[model samples]
Target: MKKTILLTLLVVSSFQNINSQEKREKDLLTSRKWYIKYMKFGENKREISDKTKNENWMLFNQNGKAEITTQGIKSIEDWNFGKKHEIINISEDGKFTEYKIEKLNESELVISRKYLNKTTTLGLKK
Candidate 1:
């Protein structure tokens, strides 16, 4: 009986830890505006035109709304994290796209998605 109770307690603790980790990651992602620094398409890497790195940006909200601004135009979209928190889903109108998280932290984010036969990666910084 003691072993069973211990095992139950361990499982619950692990679940709570995982839940808190996911919440923390989500908060980090939604806390600030991320500016585009560069983009990589397969073997080629291209830097953003403006040295200031503020020409293009993306803002994620906790309410599942996102704003993407490029060349001074902003578009509203819906966003959600995948089940495992490894992917981000963005949808506009009826079309949707999945971005796989390559790296994420307090100040930097890197995400990649497939484009045709090549993989496109976007590097962003707060």
Candidate 2:
């Protein structure tokens, strides 16, 4: 009986840890501003220069909304993550865009978007 209790406690603790980690990721993403740092368009990969680094940013909110600043212009829109947290959908000006999340962490996010026959990779940093 003691062994069974110990095993159950271990399993419960493991699940709690996983839940906490997922919550942490979501919290981090919504609390900070993310800037575009790199992008790959077609076969060309380019790094953002200091001169243009402040041109684009994304601010996600816990209320299922996001504000995007591009070229000093701001737009508010609705955004959501997939149930598995591997996809991001953004709707703006009646246009919906979906991006596959490649990586996400405290300071960086990478996403891949496909439109038409082109696939573009975007790297963002906080």
Q: Say which candidate scores most in TM-score.
A: 1
In terms of TM-score, how similar is model 2 to the real structure?
0.77
Tens-digit lDDT track for model 2 on 47-104? 8865776788889899988988877798899988766667788896877688898989
TM-score of model number 1: 0.90
Best-fitting candidate, scored by lDDT: 1
> Please, what are the lDDT tens digits per residue for candidate 1 over residues 1-126?
999999999999999998998898899999999999899999999888766556599999999999998767789999988887788988867577999999999999999999999999999989
Pull out the clashing pairs in model 1: none
Q: Each candidate's TM vs. the true structure?
A: 0.90, 0.77
Stretches of candidate 1 exceeding 4 Å from the true structure: none
> What is every candidate's alpha-carbon RMSD to the true fold?
1.6, 3.1
lDDT score of model 2? 0.84
- Model 1 global lDDT (CA atoms, 0 to 1): 0.90
Locate the minimum summed-lDDT window of 10 residues in model 2.
79-88
Clashes per model (N, Cα, C within 3 A): 0, 0
